[model samples]
Every structure is written in C-alpha cells, then in structure tokens.
Target chain A: MSTATNKKTVQLSHGGGGKEMNRLIKDIFFNAFDNPILRNEEDAAKLHFNGNTAFTTDSFTVAPLFFAGGDIGKLAIAGTVNDLAMMGAEPQYLSSSFIIEEGFAIDDLKTIVNSMATELKRSGARIVCGDTKVVPKGCADGIFINTSGVGRILNDHISVKNLQQDDVIIVSRDVGRHGAAILMAREGLALESELTSDCATLWPIVEQLIATNVDIHAMRDATRGGISAVLNEWASASNVGIEVNESAIPVCNEVSGLCELYGFEPFDLANEGTFILAVPKTAAEATLQVMKTFCHCEQAAIIGHVNDRKVGKVILNTPWGSSRYLDVPQGELLPRIC
Target chain B: MSTATNKKTVQLSHGGGGKEMNRLIKDIFFNAFDNPILRNEEDAAKLHFNGNTAFTTDSFTVAPLFFAGGDIGKLAIAGTVNDLAMMGAEPQYLSSSFIIEEGFAIDDLKTIVNSMATELKRSGARIVCGDTKVVPKGCADGIFINTSGVGRILNDHISVKNLQQDDVIIVSRDVGRHGAAILMAREGLALESELTSDCATLWPIVEQLIATNVDIHAMRDATRGGISAVLNEWASASNVGIEVNESAIPVCNEVSGLCELYGFEPFDLANEGTFILAVPKTAAEATLQVMKTFCHCEQAAIIGHVNDRKVGKVILNTPWGSSRYLDVPQGELLPRIC
Candidate 1:
C-alpha cells in the first residue's frame, strides 16, 4: 500500500510487527509520548523503585469513542492514575495497550493517542511502554485501551477496610455526570446546557490531600457503579453502618433529569472523576477544603458518617424523614460508561 | 435471567460494578488467581519494590482462542513474562485486563482463567490487579486480554544496543513453530504429527542462563516478526553487521513443510518460546551448553556472528555459499499469532 493510503487508515500490517508497525509506532506513539526510557526501544522499560508501590489497571471501551468532556484516551489515563492516586500514590509510569479494528481511521487514533499524552502530563506520568493489536473490522469496535500503572505510595494508611465509627464521608463532586454524558451521546440528545462527563485526572486533588497529611481512612473513585457502590463497599469491608442524608448528596440538574427520565437512581450512575472518602470528623473539613480548591471538586461536601449500628449496610435518609437501604446497584445501569 | 442461565454464560450485569459483578469476580478471578495482594480488594494492589525493575505490557487477540499447545490465557501470561525475561528480569507481578464480548461461555472463561493460574506458577508471578469489561455482543470477538508485568532486573547487561563485534549469535531451539501451529489450527489441517506452538514461558530457561554467570551481550524472544526482525533490530541498534548461516538455524520438519507449502521464510515466522542471544565467541560454548540442558533448546547452536563491516544489515550465508541480505520481515506474516 502507498504511504499516503497507509496514513489514512490502520491496516493489518500496521500491527504486523514489521516495517509498517515500526513506522506507525515511531511517528505517532513515540513522537507524542517521547521519554528516555521509551526511546531505549527495548521489549520492556527499565525503571528504578524503592519502598512501597501501588499498581492498578483499567480498560476503556466506551462507545462513541469520544464523549462530552472527555474521550476514551483521556479516560484510559485518568482512570488508571486515579486508581493509584486513591491509594495516596504519586502516579508515575504507565503501560498502554491498544486493540484497534483494522479499518479504523488513523486520524482518530492519533487524536486519541495525543489526548492520552496530554492527560499523562496532568500528573507527570509517562507512557513508558505499550502494545498494539489490530483485528479484522468486525472483530472489535473502534478501539479499546488498557492502561496499567505503578507509582510509589506516599501514604500507606488508606485501605478499603479502614473506616471507623464517627468517620465523616465526603463526595468529591456531583455524581452520575459520566453516565449521563455517555447516555446523552449514545441517545443523540443535545441538551441545551451541554452537560459533559466528569472525566478527569484526580491526582492534583489527591496529591494535595496527601501533602496536607489528612488522616484519610479510605478513598475510592465512584466509577462504574457510582457512589452507591462505594458506600456499600465501604460499609461491608469495614463492617460499619453508613448513614447518608440523601438530600445532602450533590447532583447536577442534568444528571438528575436524565436519571428521572430513565427511572435510574442518581446513586446508581457512574462518575469518572468523582470520588468518596472516609475520614475522621476532625479531618473532614480540611479534606473538603483541599478538594474544593480544584475547579471540578468545588461541590465536595459531607454527605454521610460511619457508625456501628446496622453493620455492613448503607442507610439513605430522605428529606421527608424516611430512610431506606442504599443497596449496591443490582443490574447493568450503563455499559462502557468509562 | 434465571440463576442457572446466568451461571452458564456471562451477562452484562456481571461487569456492571454491582453485586453480580462482585460475585463473578470473587467466584472466578479472585478464587483462581488468589493471593494476599489480590485479596485486599482495593482499587490498586500494594507492592514493595527495591532497586532496578523492568516493566512491559502486551494484548493478546489470537484467533481460535485455543491452539495445539496453549490457549489465549497461557499466551497472555507467557508473552508478557517473556518480554521481561528477555530484559533479564525475573517476572514478579502482572496485571490482567480482559475485554469480553457479552454472552461468552462461562465454561470457556473458567478454563482460560485456570490456564492463566497454571502459567503464573511457572514464573512465580502473581496477578496482583485486573480489570474486566464486557461489550455488547458483536462489538467484540470472543475476548482480548492485556497483561502488564513488573519484575526485578536480575542482570543489567542485556540490551538490544549492547551487541559488539565478534559476538556469537545463538538460537534457542527451532524457529517458526508458533506461526505454523496457529496457521494449521486456523486452516483445520489434520496433520498426522502434532505441531504445537512453542508457547512455553522462557523464564525458567532464562533464569538458568543468568545464574550460570555466562557473559551475555543481548537477548530477545523471536516473537511476532521472528528471528529476522530481531537480527535487524540488533544490527541497527548496535551499529553492527550480523551474518547468519541459514543452514545452522534449526527448523522442525512440520514447520519447514508448512513454510514450503505456504511460501514463507522460516526466519520470518514467529516463535513464542524460542529466543536469540548474543555473547562473545569465548562464551558461546558455555552459553550453548547451558541452553541445551533444556529439552526445547537441545538444538540450540551458534547461527551467526556480529561484524563491523556491514553496519545496520543482516546477511544470510546459504549452504551453497551465496550470501543474501535477510531484510526485516516487511509485511503482515500472521495476525494475532501471539
């Protein structure tokens, strides 16, 4: 195939581990994600490590490839980095792997890769190594990205089972924006307000919280199953009861409107950038202050508190003075939301 | 869906970040790849590291899922581990991410997970963290797996750019078995002899080579683009010329026969378990003796030598004494052969 034609789309030979593959990698991935370790061009990247490290992985297969606020590339980077940041680690090195359809547009791939490079810069993480595979057109959708990251843990006190009685619960931002955004894109709904997915890297806010040495008992991003999943998991893992004032939880008008239209609970929708935290009541104010400094996390608030009663359960109290169990989502609320 | 039906096949809800997703993960992934690090049930796995490390990643989308010698799960582990091993690192921890098509058989999933567990034992590596995504039916093929690995470097001397003049080039066992085996399986050719893919992990053999303390210049697995690709890379990277005796490279009967029928060069065919090494002529005897101790490397021999005359080129000397340049394999030899 002519080089001009090759530049237009991804062909099978582009992933064939030959000349075409080499040129594509160098021209795109290497050029955008250039770093000393990557330039070595070895099968693996050589790195130095000391002390405790946090490792995590995530795969992004969101439909539409590009959604409001962020695309799959941005999600891939932020998702993995957030996982490490949740553990109070400084996001460092990441390995990206792509599974692309043969006829996918090269322009789109370059856009995605460039987005990834941009996202990596937010937390100073580098794409040190990566792999690419191309399957026949119908064998896969447009593309899927898997990012695995490793970082040195700055604080080792965060754990899923670290909640204690009287610890205050905080939400980093309004929940369900990611799910609402993807749903809107999929359904072709052009709302007047132009709602976007809350997809972003949480490392900046997380780094501040760690730097301030807030006694963070547990921290987790509300991803696939949303805040309900995080609250429910914390209760079960720590064997504590979590009582949340439903009205105190922040939710954007767009997400609440979409949830009502689809008969879905806001707590059940996913959020890419939102997170939940459990900290001693004394540290809750400081944590919220640090989080609110970030533009997207300005809505951070104390929505709940941990207690010993009703162990292993999450209770949601309504504004009407009634309460119900805020159970973990039971069915598929949304697929490929992040 | 009924519980029985749900047990028979994976449902979208199983990856929905809900109770069902929790059960699926605990029942399958956690139960098989059990380890303390994985059991922590956090967004990231906490690990301790010191000194130099090697990191790499790969995504496997091989067709047929299962071949004569191994399945996708085995290939996923072996491939990533080999990348680290080729860098003279002892494979330690791995992160697995799976993108599955909705409605894939649960039985097949179990078999694949079990194979992964079995393969992990071969290199003493743990699946410390993982992610799973399920796409709608027809959005993906059966499944694609991405594995990212981290290991401690056992020897820092091996590198693609470390080859030097008079370095003896060695091949571990036969070339082209993996490509030919996948092709046979794809074509459904019932060859009388079983021609299994050389899909074994290389850590054990590599560990011995390192322990022997034999001087080594560089090493790489003859994977996707095969030995020809490695020779060209080494020559280009180290600014040296590589001259190979074509007849000295081992080629099994089945692979040779299949290559002849398909009009493919053995040097350009992929091999999963086989590898190439560069060592000084003085250390060639010890290197070959150590390699031959393993059954698969019984035919290991010196295939060529590095010289300074023809930098950035690989020349092949045929049995008839005519020399030809064995250029890097330029086209797609086989897709998803890993």
Candidate 2:
C-alpha cells in the first residue's frame, strides 16, 4: 500500500495502473515527448500512411547505460531509426516501451527521456505511443528500452538481395569506434585520446542520398557483427562475392590500438552509426561525394567491389597482396555492444 | 569464444549477431512466425498502408512466465492486439522483440514463441519484424517480451474524449479475473472452482460490433486499474461525469472471495479481455446484444451513464440508495500483474 508521491526513486506503485502510475507517465514520458498525437491520450496513436511503409523494432540493453558519445537513450532511438533509414525510409513514427527496475532514480529516468527527445528531433520522428513496466529490484538491470518504428519508404529498391555485379562497397566512415569505445569504458581505460562512439542519427545523410537519387543497391548499418557480418549477409543473399582491400578500409588509431591489445578484429567490431553501402560502379563517386559532405562521414571511402568469382563469400586482400576469406563471425565477439 | 552448437540452453553467442544467432533465429523464430514479409530478410519490413492507421506498443514482464490461463507470450500478443481493437482498428502487423537471460531453456523459449504464433492467428495479424537480445545470466528475469503493432483504423470516431452526454456505459463481462488470477498464481491459492484469466484476443468481438454499425464513442479494455481507471480517464478527458450502479457491475464469485479476503475492491482490479464501451442510449441494447452473443462476454450489462451533473468525476450509486464519488484507485494494488 505504498504511495509514490514525492518519491526520489520509482516505486512499484508507479507501475500499478492507478493514480500514481498515471502521474508518473504524465510527468516523465508525456512531458518530454509532448506532441498533439501523444496528447490525444487514446489507447493507440492514429496516423496516416498512404504508401509503402517500413517497420522495424529493436530493444536496447547496452550495459553501463552511459558511454563516451551517447547513452542507452540515444542508442535506443538511433538504432530503430537507423533500421528504417537503411531501407531508404523517411523515419516518421516511433513507439517506445521501457522496462525499468524498481528503485531506479527519477533523475536518471528523466535524463534518459530527455536524451530520447533530443534524438527524435534529428529525424522529425514522433513518439506516438508507448508503455512502461516497472519490475521489482533485482529482477532486472537498471532499465531496458524497446523502440519500434514505422516510416514511409522513400525507395523500394534498397535491400540486402539487391546488390549488383561490380557494385562498389563503401564504408560510411572509420569502423570499430563504437565497439572499441565501449570496451575501453568497461575495462576502465581512460585513454588521453578523443575516442567517442559514432552514435548519431543517419537519417540526415540517408535523406541526402535519396534526394540525390544515388541508386542504393544494398545498405546496412554495421551494428552487432560490424562490416564483416554485413558483407557476409549481403554476399549470401545476393549470391555475389565481395572483394575488399584491407588497407583501404578506414580505422581510427584508437580503435586499432584497442583491437590490437584485445586480439579482436576491427572489421568484426560493432559501429552504432557507421553503415556500409553497395552501389553500382557508376554511382560510387556520387554516393561518396554525398556521404563525405557530412562531418561524421568525412572519411567515407570505397572499400571493395562485388564480383562473381568467389560467389557467396567475402574476400579480403591484405597489404601484402594475399587474399583470404572473411567468413561470418562464428562466435561471440562482444556482448551488449548496442 | 565458446559456441552455441546444439546447446540445450541459450548462450550469449545466440544474440551476438553471428552464425549461432542467425541459426537460432532461423530455426525457431522464422519457423514459427513464418510469412512472406518476414522472409524478405530486410532491416525493416516493407508494408503497404492506405488511409489512417493505428500504432501501439507494450512490454510484458509478468513474473512466473506461466499463469493459470495465459502465459506471458499470449498476453504479450493479445495485449497489443487488443489496443488496436479498442480503437476500432483491424490488427494487421506486429513486431516482436525478446530479451532473454543467458542459460534460459531452449524448450521454454520454443513454447513461448509457439504461444505467440497461436495468438497472432486469432486476429490474423502477422509478426513482420523482430529483434532478439540475450544478456548474461541473472541480468534479467527468465525472459521479457515487447510487442508493437500497427493496424488500419476503421472508425475514427472512437476516442477517450468523445464521450457524449447520456452515453450508456456497458462492461463486457465480470471484472477482476486477470488480476485475481495473477494474484492467485503468485500466492499459490488452490481454488477448486474454475478461475481462469480472461486473456483472449478481443478483435473478433470488436469487429462484430463495428460491423453492426454501433455508434461507439469511447472504448477501452479494463486492463490495469480495472473499470475504475477507465471511467475516471473518460470522465476527465471528455469533461463529463459518469454515474455507475454499483450492483449492476458483474463480479465473479472467485474474484469476490479474493477481494473480500485481501481488503480490496473489485473495481480497482485488472481484466485483460474485459472492456468498457460508451455509446448513445439508442445503441446500448445493440452493443449488449452483440457482446452477449460471445461466450466469454455473456454477462455483458449496462453499468453506468455519462452526464453533466458533476464534471470530471465518477459517482457510484450503491444498492442502499446512497451515492459516493469513485475516485481513481490509489497506491499499488498489485505489481507485475500484467
């Protein structure tokens, strides 16, 4: 029979579906994501969609909650939004659900909610509907957020199986920053260098590519298993072999150092905002030009090209002019990277 | 660098975005919720939507996982589907995400997924997209599920703020079954009589009502906080008063016994499948007739009416000829009852 009034931390009563729960939702979630659709206060949000739409979902359980570049809040929003953007969709409406542990600080929740609001602004997407569940202490970690997004598809040609022969593979920027940054934070390594996660909304850049009509064949963000995973999936799905020059792939000094020290492959490390693109050879220069215009993607480069010689495989050519198969990562590299 | 080859329980590698993870998704998830959209294998599922759509999201963290009538899997599907049905929408697409703890039994995970697939068949809603994440042992309770759904809005007139004066309020069936069932399971009450949760998909019944052309004003499932919370919300949002006949509200014997022993009110308990509807007095008989035709809602009855006597409040008329304000339930009734 405990009341949650004037409490510093969340209580079980805050999720009891009663007066206290209503007040908490209005105070935190509604206050931060204020909009007309949300204010309607209906059981669900009513929206208009008149064409091909893209729907995606992701649950963020990144440990440490906070990191060098962004917190779980920003990652939750950006992750789902990027899934839609990678399909050449205009990120529009998102639904967020939170499972918070009891006794979690109100201040921390507010900070996370505010971060979500800030990230939503980058893509003009609105948090139209949501649910909150509070579990007893020790039942769960601090909190986990699941975001599901539905957006209007700007181009229907973007897909993993759409890669064309002789298509150029482009890495948006330096790989492995996000995975390396998280590793450093977990290892308690306070490096003197500036190494932050490449965690930002990619809609702005994707929109520019779409507006420029750069015929994107295949596009995917290297999230969990990084570029190696994406290349393998694309190779199998499109039945094309990928040839990449290892020396041409961009890797920051910090990430390379972390990988060297930890015996991890840079290509297999996750990236929050970095994405790989497969475009026709004729559109490669135009795509690179558009991507480089963005500050975060200034180092975007052509890393490889699609070929049929080694079908259903990814071939990496090292600086020594010897090539080897870059198979799909078979075991766990890192946990909770996203 | 351990692998999950033929493992009986889940490992961290199953969510590591590698070979093991892909195999698990394909063998279990893709096999159960199979459909063309899901088989497309894109970052986002491409859907075609014309006109208005309804979107909603929910996360299920029910303790014990299994319950008297429905498990968390079925609850997760029906809960989100019911939200869309409450808005006079046809549930169409759903995205499911699972957060599993390391070492959770593969057999149990399969059963939950099977339950979700079974429930989705009730509303003809397809799970078009999903995400899965696994944490280290003890980071989460056995498992948690989050489902987000989008559907086409059939009737835009139904809203929380659309209640008109003299609108008759009809409850679908007896109240408090869901909350009582969960409580009983948690407390280990071996009641002999049948006392199962009313956790079924309500779209079929709602569709019948919509097809009958009933002029529905406000409709909401009495999930958490039961009918009391729903009525209070309607009154405040529509700026009207609701007068409910206390005795007219139906309550099962099991629920009554539990409430009497626990010093609780049945009005404040939760019901998963039970719902309340507000329609003009002329449409009241039709609504009840439609509801009564369903076996689960055979006890459908008119319990209240909307009026301007007391703005933004609910009044309960007792059998003793005395009336009192029915304030929204306060404090915690039960946590994780969903």
Candidate 3:
C-alpha cells in the first residue's frame, strides 16, 4: 500500500495516483518522454493547430510484448503515428495511456517506456499526455497501451475515396514480415537467419514522398487485416477495381517460406511498418524511386493499377497468366498481432 | 473461426480484421455512435481545428463494468471530456479504442457502446475515430476503453499555475459520491437509500461560466485522488497556500457514512463528475450562482480561499477551532477507479 515493494515487480500503488505512482511516472515516463507540452502538468495538454488536422487512436495488446525485433511499445507509437502519416499528415503529438496488471515486472515496464521514447524520435512526435491504471492481478495479461495522436495534414488531398482510375498501387516493401515474425516467435520456429519485424516508423519515407510531390491518392499501412484488407476497403470506398500482378508484388523469401509453412497468404498477414500507396500512373516511377532511398524499402515496387472493371473487387494476376478474385481477408487470421 | 458463435458472446474473429470484425464494428459500435465523420470509414478521422486546442487521454479499467449511476463506457467518455472541460475547453471530437477479451458477451458490448453514445449527447462530442482489438480470454479482464479527446479552448487562462493569492476555492457540489458509489457497488453493500456516482458531464456548467466571463484562475476535476489531490497540486503548482473551511465543504451523508466505514477521508475519495475551481474572491458568488442552476450542482458552495501564509500547502480549518495540513493522498485508495 506504500512505496515499499518487491522492486522486481510493479505494485498496486504504482498506479494509485500517489507518491509511488508519481515516482514511477517521473522516474520512467517523465524522464523518457520529457517535453514542454508534457511538463506543463495540466490535466489536458494545450496544443496549437491550424487548418485541418488528423486524429487517430490505436490500442496495442500484442502477445509476448517483446517479439523478434520490436516490442509492444514500438508498435504502439508507430501504429498510431502511421495512421496520421497515411493521411499525408505530419506526426506531431501523441498521448500514451498504460493499463498495467499488478505484479508485472517493473524492469519490463522501464524497457517498454524506453522503447516508446526511442520510437518517438523516429517521427519527432512528442507524447504530451498519459494515464496509468493498475488492475488487480489476473485482471490483465501484462501491459496494454493505447496511443492517440493528432497532426496537421500537410497534403489534404490524400483519401481512400480519391483512388482514381489508372492510379498505380505501390507496396512500400516486402509484405507480411510483421505477421510472420510474430508467428515465428510465438510458435518457436527456427530458420537459417533470424527474421525481424518490419516495425520501423514510415513517416520519414512518407515525408519524402510528399516532398517529391508524388500525388499520393491513398496511403495505408498493411496492419491487422494486412494489404488485402486495405485494398478491399479502398476498392469499395472508391468504387474502383484494383488489378495487381502477383509476380510484381514484393515478398521476402523468409515471409514466403513462413507463409508456406503456416498455410497462410503473405498478403493476408499484418505488417506494422509496411504501407501500400495509390498514386497516378505517371508518378509510379518517381514514388518507387523515392521510397527505395529509405531503409528497408529497397524492394518497393509498382504492383497494381486501379480500373473500373470488377468494381468493388481486387483481381490478382498470377505468373501463368491466370487470375482470381483476391477476397478481403476473413476469419481470425491472427489476433493481437499488432 | 468465422462468425459462428453462441450468439450471445463476442468471438476472436470479430477483431481479426475480416468480415466478422467489420460486421461487429458496424452492428455494435458504428450503429451506436452513428455520425458522418465515423461513417467515412477512414483509418483516421479528419478534423479541422484552428487556434489553441486542449487534448487529453484516459484509459478506463473500472471493474464491474456496470456500476451505480454509470458504467465504464460512461466513465470513459466523461473522464476524458471532463479533463478538457476543466481546462475551459468545449468538448468536440473524441477517439475511442477498445481492448476486449475474447469470448466476452456481445450483448454486454452493445450495452457499453450504448452508454458511450448516450454520454456523448451530454456535450455533443462526436466519436470521430476509434480502434478495437480482442485479446484471447484471460489476457484482459473484460474490456478496457481508452478515449482521447480534443476541443477548442474557450478560456485559455484556466490553469493550475494561474491561481492567485486571494482566489476563492469553490467545490462544485457534494464530493466523494463517485468513490463511495463504486465501493458500495463492488462490495454489494445494502443501503436503504440508493447512492450513485456523481458521474455526469460538466461542460454545460463550465460553458455557462465561460460565457459569463468569470475570471477563472484554475479548474480541475477531482478524479483519481479527489479534492485533496487537486488542492495539493494547485497549491504546489502556484506556490500559494489554500485555507479550506471544513464546515463549508459539502459532503453528502451517504458518502460521509461510507468514508467512516472504510476509514477513508471524504476529501481523499475519487470523484468522476465533481470539480474544484479557484476564482477571484470577488467572483465566488457569481460562480456559485451560475453553477447552482445545473441539475446536480444544487449544493454548490464556496469552501475555501487561497492564502499566502503556508506556501505549497492546504490548511483545513475544523469547527473545533483547530486546523491540520491536508496532505496529498499517498497510498492506493482504490484501483480501477476511472
């Protein structure tokens, strides 16, 4: 009930809004996410925004907390900020809230907080406000974080409804690494080389595309439902058919091998940092060029084009000159992969 | 792993970014929080905000999802919205994210979502954006909701640090009802008269105060650590002493009784809808006059005054002609208290 604790694990008082909670917040969160807006110490953060802004929220309950390459903390920040970036917005401010289960390791908490601080540097976003709640033991697994963010839209023209006919689709890199990595970690699969999650922040690449004036019509990270989900939604929203050459879509060998082993489709698996973009056919080359200059994006390629045929559907062209309707992913691909 | 289930409970595939998940979102969440912004179905909500805005985030893990007077959904919306209101901001757009444990009842989700929609009507705030994830059963308690909100600041001078030496402190109404109500609900205590949490939207009263142009110095909801916590923070933030008349402070008989039974201080109990305000001594009567017009604020009264005597401290003067330093709460009073 007081400050005294096992030191190895979190205590109920660590979230009690008292001296101990103050210590944890200060020693860990405040120290890592130190910023003027956060240091203001008000109930809500004061922000100045002009014109249009993008707001988004995401909750990360990824199992194992720590995966092959990233932890839940990294995914939490990247995922929310990426939502802003996909809207052609500059990631600016974020709010982090933690739901910690009693008796969870304190050292692990520090590590997660540190990962969050490190991830913030990827997009220059600041965590301005946060809340911590400790539940009774067994009430929660370990820790779950909910991050919400807002940023000014640098290019207001980007939207899922803006995918015009003849717009070319580009995958930022090889798809499905995130889902595969988590699967591998959870199933204890061994491979010749370790496969890490593609959980890096995509803002820098997005910023470059904006700088180059690539005429981005629609941008979305292949998270949760993965590329298939994003494409299906775009097709239905814009009332356009998307045709993709299966041979052209980038898929790393590790991801392909894992998909084969697990009887899953690479396009249906989640990707934390990977994104799919819709740009005018004329901007395809330029978009790919700009994307390839970024780390982990060397495999970026133009793989599809929007059309009026097969409205509200995605058609995938195979290597043998055959095609099939690429349906929206269905039924429990994976839970808590994010 | 498709939509087939017991019909009364939620399934894992409902969060798998597939047909089932889309159906769940539309049938439950979207149906309850119907609006153009939410219907757009974009990854993030597009909002236009000019000038200064107040942003806040809160995660609600309150146990017994349904409690006296309000549920967790109501608490989630009101808690974040209240933070904005306390900063003299108009509650506008809110983002809600949910972390659900697999196999939870679907009917319960509908009830919670409905509660959130009804609460949104309290301040006309729109649910502009949201996220949902389902963790395997036992990974989460039942459901945890995180709400992040942003709104235009109506009175920019409202801040804890803005407290002045002669500012009078006003207690919005009788305090400790929320904390006591939750306790009673959890313990299944039998009481002749029903006691409910003071959980209601405060923006209506706050808007009126702003419209009247009362020189508001500091405003804060006594949420987690209650009035004692807010006063201590204000005193420390402004380096001013606060002298509170114990007799003038309002405490309902129900709350006072529960406080005595639990060995808890009424002032130290959390309040969901109650707030404390510091205004110029000359405007105390005007503020009370405006507040009393509201439904739940009939007991509004001036409870204390700011002083220069004991900097960074709150002195509680009892009717016995003795005073004691009211310290900031320092231990776990109750966990998962909104």
Q: How would you encode candidate 1's per-residue C-alpha lDDT over A229-289 as one tens digit per residue?
A: 9999999999999999999999999999998899999999998999999999999989988
Q: Rate the local accuracy (lDDT) of all candidates.
A: 0.93, 0.93, 0.91
Is model 1 an incorrect, acceptable, medium or high docking prediction? Answer: high
lDDT of 2 by residue, A125-204 (tens): 99999998889988889999999999999989999999989999999999999898888888887466589999989999
lDDT of 1 at A126: 97
Clashing pairs in model 1, backbone N/Cα/C closer than 3 A:
none
TM-score of chain B of 1: 0.98
lDDT of 1 at A176: 91
| Order of candidate numbers by lDDT, starting with the best | 2, 1, 3
- Model 1: per-residue lDDT, tens digit, B1-338? 68897779888888899998899899999999999999999999999999999999999999989998999999999999999999999999999988988899999999999999999999999999999898888999998999999999999999999999999999999999999999998888836668999998999999999999988899999998899999999999999999999999999999999999999998999888999999999999999999999978999999999998799999999999899999988878888786
TM-score, structure 1 vs. true? 0.99
lDDT, candidate 3, residue B202? 92
Report the C-alpha lDDT of model 2 over B270-300, residue by residue, as the tens digit: 8899999999999999999999999899999
lDDT of 3 at A338: 84
Candidate 3: tens digits of C-alpha lDDT, residues A1-338: 44356577787778877777878888889999999999989999999998999999999999879988899999999999999999999999999999999999888999999999999999999999999999989999999999999999999999989999999999989989899998987887735447889998899999999998889999999998889999999999999999999999888899999899889999999999999999998888899889989999999998899999999999999999999998888889778898
True contacts kept of each: 0.88, 0.86, 0.90
